[model samples]
Target: MFKRILSALSGKKSRTSTPVSSVHADASPPSDESELITVYDSYGREMKITRNEWRDNVLLPNLQQKWSDADELYSLIISGLNDGFVADLIPAAAQLVAIDSNPERSHVIQGIVLLENGQLDAAETTLRAGMAKVGATGTLLTNLAKVFTERGEQALADETLWRAVQTEPNLENGMLWWAAIQRERAGEEGYLQALRTVAALPGSWRAQLWRARHYLEHNDVEPARALYAEVLAGGRFDGGALMMISGDLGNNGQIPLIIELIGPVYDEHKHDAMAGINLLRAYQELGNADEGQALLARLYALGFMPIKSQLDQFAQVFEQMRKQDVQGVPIDPESLKFTTLALNQPIWHYGLRNADWFFAQKPEGASQVGFFAFSKSTDGAEHAESQREDELGRLSRAIPLYLAEAVHYWSDHVGTCYIQIVEGGGPVLSGAEADGQALFDIVPPMMKYFVTGEIGCSGEDDQVQWQIALSLWDCATRTKSATESGSAVKADLGALVLDLETRLLAGVGLGREAPLDSFYLRPTAEVLPVYLTELGQSFMLTLLANGHVPKSSMWGERAMLDWPLNMALHWPTLEVAKLMYICGLGKALDYQSDVLAEYKERSLQMLRELEQARSPALRLAPLVWKVFGMQAELHAYIRELPADTSPEHKAWLDRVSES
Candidate 1:
C-alpha cells in the first residue's frame, strides 16, 4: 500500500486531452422561456440568464432570427460549447472517431482518446480522416503528430504540429500546445513563439494562464508573478484561477509564497470558503495554529463553518504538548498496549493527505493484521450530473489496483485483509453528498455474522458487511454547523469502542474459524489509544482496551512516523485546553473502573479537567463531551457496587492522579 498516488497526468486544459470542442446548436426561441440558459461567461464560470434576456442584451430582439450566417452560426455554436449552451463534458474522456457535433475537433478528441487508450491504429485512422476534411486544422494535425510520436515517429509528430500552427495561425490552444512541444524540439525558437502566441491574444485569460503555467513550471518566478497579478487584477476570483494556482504552490511545499500571493485575495474575498481553506492549509503547514485558529474564528464570525477536520488536527498538536510539557503529566508513549505484536507501514501509506488505520499486531515482530487506508482522488467537480458515475468508475478501478499493491506488500497475510476507500471526490466546499458506502463495504460475512450494529447502521440501514467502522459526515460549507444530517455511525469514539468490544467478545473481527479474541482479532481487551492527524495537527485517544503490545510499540517501523516522530515539526501554538478534553474523553474510552481496574484515578482527573474545558476547536460534533457523560456513568456503576465485595475498594477511592 502507498500513502499518496499523484499520477503525473497532463494538468493542462489542452494537454490532458488532444483538444476538445463541446457541442451546441442554434434553436428557435421558445414561447414561454421561464428557465434560463446557463453558459460559461468569461473564465469558465457559469453565467445564467434567460434566452430572451440574451436576445434583449446582445442581439436586441430580432438578432436571434437574423443569425443565419453559417460562419457566425458555427462560431456561436462552438463558442457557446465553450461558454454557454454547453451540451456535455466527459469523465476520463470518450475517444472520438467522428462525432457529428463538431467533426473536426471531435475527430481530434477521438484520435487522442484512442491513442491514450492504446489503440494506435484506430487513432491514426481517425486522425487521417479528420485531416482530409479539415485540412491541417490544428486539432487534427497536432493529435496525428502525437500518434506518430507514440509510434516512434517523433519527427512526424513534430512536423505535423508545426504544420498545424503554420496553417491555422490564430488557433489558440493549438499554438499553446505546439509551443509546449516546440520548447523541447525547437528549443529557444519554440519559447519565442509561445511568447508571440501570448502577445497575439491580448486580454485572453486562458492564454495568459497557459503562459503563466509555463513560467511557474520552469521556476521562472518573476514572469509567473506578473501574469498572476494581471489575472488577479482582471477580477477572476470566482473563476478559481487563483485557487488553482494556490493548489500548485501548496502541493510543492511553497507555503510562504502562497501566503504572500493569496493574502490580499483572501482579505478581499473572506466570504470564499475555498479561499479560506487554502490559506488555512498554508498556516497549518507553517504550524501556526494560533493564526489558523484565528482564520477559523473569522469563518465562524462570518457564519460559515468550513469542515474543521484540519482544525481539529491542528488543535491536537498543541494539546499533546501541553499535557507532556506544561501540565507535567509525564505522558509516556510506553503507556499504549497493543493486542498484536507490531505494525508495518507499507509504501502506500507514505504521502496520504488524510488516512487512518486500525491494527492488530501478531506475536511475530513487525507484522500487523489490520486495515490501512489512504485515498486516491480525481476531482469530479463542475460535472454534477456525471460525478456519481465517474466517482464509482474511478473507485472500481482503484480497488483492484490497491489489492494488487497489498498482495505485493502484505504477502504473508493468510486471507483477504485491509481496505482503502476514496473520500470527497470534489472539494468538500462544493456541498455535494460525500460518499461513505465504500467504507462500510468491508466484507459482508464479517459484518453480517459478527460486528453487525457495532458502528451504527445495521444490515438494512447500511448493506456493508465488513468489520470496519465507518461514519459518514456530510459537511455543509455555507452553514454554521460543520455537519448537516450524518449517517448512523456513532458520533463519539466511546460508543464506537463499546460496540467494538461487543463485536470482539462475540468473535467478530477474527477470521472465520478463529475463536473469540483470537490472535487474528487482538481485541483491545481493556484500553486502546486512538490517533488522528491532518496537515499539521493530531489527536490522541487514551481509551481503555484489550491487547499485549510490544515495548517497541512506543516507536517502531509502521509507527507514528510523522508528527509523533518529530514533535518539533510545525509545533502547534494555539489552544491547549481542548486537547486536555480530548485526552479526558480518550481516557474515558479506556476507563477501567470495574472494581479491580487501576486507571480509575486517572479517569477522575480527566473528568475534572473536562468541566473547565471551554474551547471551540472541536465544537463541530464534539466527541469529548460524550466521553465525559460516559465516564460519569462508568464512575457511578463502580460506586453502586458494595465496598465490602470490591477488590481494594479503599485504596481505589483514595488513589491519586498518576504524574
Candidate 2:
C-alpha cells in the first residue's frame, strides 16, 4: 500500500516496449563502382580505393589484414577501422603511410590507432604533431582539449579552449564549455554572466535552465519562479525544477501556494519526510488542527516521534492558562507565562501552590518555564554547576552581585524559590546557616566582597553599582548568624528591614516597587504580625490626619491590610476597620454585594432573552447566561459574612475553598 502511494505520488510510468538491435543478418555487398572508399585527407583533398586491389595490395603484403572481408574488402576495412579492430587496421595504417599525399592525415590516423591501442602518450604526441601540420583550428583544438581534459590536465584543457574561443568566439559548444569552467572556478555571478550571454544566442534552452538554477542557488525565488513558469509554459515539466520552486515558495512563507506547487511531488514521493513535515507545519499554522493532527499521526506511523520534552512543554502552557482563567485574569501573550506554557507544562508546584503569586501580578515579565532532568554523574554535576555559575556570573557582572543574591535568598523564604540539587549522598545537606557560612568561606573573593559590603562596591562609574543598597542590607543580615539567639538575629534583621524601608521611601527604584512589597510584607507579617498590627493603627491615624493614604503607600498598605480585615470581627477595634477601609477591602466587600445583586438580575434578563431567541444558535445563549447565575451564587456567599467580619479572612477562606 505504501509503495503504491509512493509510486502514485512520484509520477513514474510503466515501460512499454523492447529496444531493437542495430545489427542485421543477410546483408548484401555494394556494387564494384559504389564499393570505392573515399578518404578525406588533412589538406581537404580526397582519395579513393577499390575493394580487390586495396585488400590484395594492403592486406596480404603487411601481414596485419588477414581478417579483411572477401566480398566487400574496402567496406570491411572502413568498418574495422571505425570499430578499432587493431590487427586489421594496422595494415590500413601502413597503407595510409605509403600513400603519402597527406602526411597530416596519416599522422592523425596513426594517433587514433595508437589511442585505441592504449598508448596515450604516443597518441597525444602524434595528435600534437598532426595538429601543427594541419594548422590547429576550432575542430582540432577542441579534440586535443577533450584528450587533455580526459587525462585530468584541466588547466591545459581550459587554455586550449580559450585559444579556440579567441579563433571563433561564435563557436556555441566552445562558449558553453567556457561558461561551465568559469562557473566551477568563480561561482554563481560568473556563471550567470556567461549563461546570460549564451541565453541571448538563438535557440538555447540549456542556457535558460542554467540561468534558472543560478537564481535558485542564490535564493532569488521570484526570478527562479518566473524562469520555471517560462519552462513549464513551453511544455517542459522538469520534476526536479518543480520540486525546487515548491520548496523555495514554502521557505519564503508562501503558505497557500506551497501545497499546490508541491502536491505533485508529494504524490510522487509519499515517504519524503521534507514534504510531509512541511505539509504538517503549513496545516498547523493555518489552524486546521484536525488536518494537522492527522498529518502528525501519519508521521508517527512513518516512525517519527515528537520529542517528549516538547509534549510536556505544551501541556504546561495549557495548565497555566487554565489557572489564569480561574483567577479572573487575562494571561499576557508576551509574558514569560505564555512563552513557558507554549514550550512545556508548568512545574509541579506552579499553578498548584504558587498560582496566587502568578495571579496576583499582571503576568508580565514572569520567568519562562523550562524543564531539566538530572542524572547521577560527576560530569552531569559539573555541567549543572557550570550552567548555574554562568547565569549567576551574568547577573553579577552586569548588575550588582549582592542585589541579585539578596533577591534570590529572600525569595527562598517567602516565594516558591527552590533549588533541587541531585546530590549522590549518604546524608542530605541543607542550606541552613552552617552550610551558608561554609559555602561563603569557599566562595570567590569578588563574591565575598560583594556579600560583606567590605569594598563598598558602588558608584555611577561602577558597573554593578545598582546593587549597592541591597548589598548593604545583605551584609547586615549575614552578620547575625542563624544559629545565634533569636533575639540577636531578629534585632539584626529588624534593623536591616528598617534601613530598606528608609531607602524605599527615598525612592531609589532599586527593583519594581509594586511586586517587592510582598517580599517586604511577607517577612514582617509572618515574623512580627504583632508589630504590624500596631503599625497598622499608627498608619491609619496618619492617613486620617492627611485625609488619604499616599499612592506609594497604597500597595504596601494593602499587603499589610489583609491581616487586619481577617482579624477585624475578633478585634472590633477602630484601628482594624480603619486599616481595612484605608486599604480598600471594606469598599471591595460592599462592591461585591452590589455586583452579586446585579448578576442575579442579569441572570433573569438572560433567561427572558433566551426564550425570545427563536434560532438554534440563539438557543445556546442560555448556556452563557448560566455564568451570571454562578456569579450570583458567589456573591450570596460573600454577603452572608457578618458586617464586622474581616474581608481578608473571608477572602482567605474563599481562596482555600476554591482550591
Candidate 3:
C-alpha cells in the first residue's frame, strides 16, 4: 500500500465522516487575540494561518461568483468542514454547486458537508443529483458508497466502490476501498486479485502501484520490480510515486533497491523529503558514506527543518565514517588554497546598520582596523595539550567578531572582522597564522591596522588552561605597534577574552572608560562565549542563505541556532545577541523550520518589548512580524513609527514593508 493515501477529504482517520464531537464544536471565527490558526496533518506537517483565511480565500471569491474559484475550493472546503465550520460551509458549498465551474467537485463537497452534519438523506439526494447532472465521477460515487456504508448496507457500499474504481481506477481512495473489501472477503490472495483487476485497466497507475506494494510485502521481487518499472514509466511517475515505491521497498528491507530506484529519479530541488531520506538511508546502510554525505548536504540545503533530526544523524554518521578513514593523516596542503576572496562583507543583524553605511558614517582618515581569527597554535607544546576541535573551530571565528565589535563600539575607528574564504567555502582560521608582512599584504589596502593572534591550550581535563597572544600591526608603518596576551583556565575563557578586549582597546589607543549609555553591552563572562558563538553561527547561516557559503561546507548540530536563540532573550542590551537571534530566525524561516511556529509567540513577545524601545533596533519588530507573515500587525507597527525616523532606517523599513 502507499505510505499516504491521496484524497480530497478532511480527517485522515475517516475521509467519509468527521466525528460528532467535531460536528458540535464551536464554529466562531478566531479573533485578533488569537493571532495564528495552526493546522497540522497526521504526518506532523503544520500550516500557520489566520482565522478569516478561509473566508478570504474561499467564501469571498465564491460570493463574488468567480467560477474559477469554485474549482479549487475542494481542499479549503475540507478544512472548513473539519474545523467545525459546518454552518459557514453549508452556504459556501451551495455557492460552489451554483457556480457550476466544477460540478462534480462542488457536489461532492456539499454531500460530504451534509453527511458530516448527520444529514444522510440530503447527502445521498445531492450526490445522486450531481451524478445525474455531470455523469459519474469517482469522488461522487465514493461519497455515495459512504452513505450506503453509514446505513449498514455493506453490499451496496461494495458495489458502489467497485463502480467508482471502474469509473476512475486512478482514484486512490476507491481502489483502496475495493481492495480492502476483496481482502476481507478472501485474504492476501483475494487482495492481490482485486489489485490485479484494477491494474489491468489502461490508466491504472495507482492500482498498479498498490499491487506492486502488495508483492513487495510478500517478498515477491520480480513481479514487484516489473510493476514498479511499469508504473514509473507511466504518465503518473512523479515524486509521490517514487516516495511510495521507495518507502515500501525500504520497509521490506530492500535498501539497495531504494538507491537504485530513487537515486536516479529523485530531484532534491523538487521532490519531497521522504524520497531523499530513503535514498540517504540506503547509502548509509550500504556504507556509501560519500554519497550519503553529499545527499545529506543536498537535503540540508532544502532547509526543511521537520527532517532535521534525521539529517543531523546522517551527518554525524557520515562524518564519523569520514574521520575513521583519516584519523592520523596529515592535512592536505591543497585544501588550503582558494580564490575569489574578499573582506568586510556584511553579516546579517536585524537592527544593525550595514558595513557600507558604517564606512560612509565613519570620520575621514579614521583608522580602519581588521581583526583576523586566531588560529590554533600548531607547535609541539600546544599539540600535547587538552583541546577539542569543535570548541577551537567555534572560537576561531567568534573571537575576531568580538574584537572587531569592541573596537567599533569603544573607539572612533571603523573596525571589522577579516575572514579568509576556504577553498570550497568557509571562514578560514589558518589564514590568521600568517606572518605580519604576509598579513599586511593580504588585508584590504584601506585598512591601516591589523590584529592577529594564536590561541593555545595546555594542561589536561579539569586543569586545562587557555592562552591567547595578540599583536597589533600598523600597516602604514610596516611594523608591529603593540602586543597583548592573556590566559585562563578552561572555565574562565570568557574572562580571558574580556581582559584581552580591554587591553586590545588600549593597544589601539582608545582605552577610555565605557560609556554609561553605550550602544553595545559588554557581555558578562558567562554570556560572552555563548553570545560570540551565536554571532559566529549567525554570520555563517547568513552567508549560507545569501549563497556566499555552500551548504556542503556546513556541519555541526542545529543547536548552533537553537541555543543562541534561547540565550538571546537574556541579553537584551547586547546588540550582537539580538542580531544573532534575528539572523538565526531569518535562516529558520527561510528554511521553513518547524521551530518558526514553535518560536512565533516568543517572537511576538519580544516584539512587544521592542515596540517600547527608541533604538533603531525597534524597527526589527516589523521584520519579525513580516517574516511570520503577520500582515495586519506589521502594517499597524509600520504606521506607528515616529515620523522623524532617519532616511536610512525609513528606507529599510519601507523595503521590508513592501517586500
Which has the greatest TM-score? 3
Q: Please rank every candidate by lDDT, starting with the best.
A: 3, 1, 2
Cα-lDDT of candidate 3? 0.66
lDDT of 1 at 122: 84
Stretch of 10 with least lDDT, candidate 3: 1-10
lDDT of 2: 0.37
Residue ranges of candidate 3 with Cα displaced over 4 Å: 1-73, 80-89, 237-239, 267-273, 287-362, 365-372, 378-394, 412-453, 457-496, 499-531, 534-659
For every candidate in turn, the CA RMSD to the true structure comes to 25.8, 32.4, 9.3
Query: What is the lDDT, from 0 to 100, of the residue 591 in candidate 3?
Result: 45
- Candidate 1: worst-modelled 10 consecutive residues by lDDT: 1-10
lDDT scores for all predictions?
0.38, 0.37, 0.66
Candidate numbers, best TM-score first, in rank order: 3, 1, 2
Tens-digit lDDT string for candidate 3 (1-659): 00111112222231222211111222443445335555432222345655466446534454344324554455446556655556666776777787756667778888878877778999899899899989978888888998888889989988888888888887766788788888998998898898889988777788778877878878898888888777766647544677788889999998888888778778876566778888888898888898997687677655444565577678788877765664333455564554433334334442232313222344666677888777777664322221123566678777877787777667766777766654445555463375888877777777878888887778887577878889899988999998888888878988889999888777777543663224557788988878777767766665565566566555553556555545755555665555566667766655444435545544565555566665444546666776779899877876887988677767766666665
Error of 1 at 27 (Å): 43
Candidate 1 stretches greater than 4 Å from native: 1-109, 116-141, 148-177, 185-193, 202-222, 235-244, 247-256, 260-280, 286-659
Clashes of 2: 13
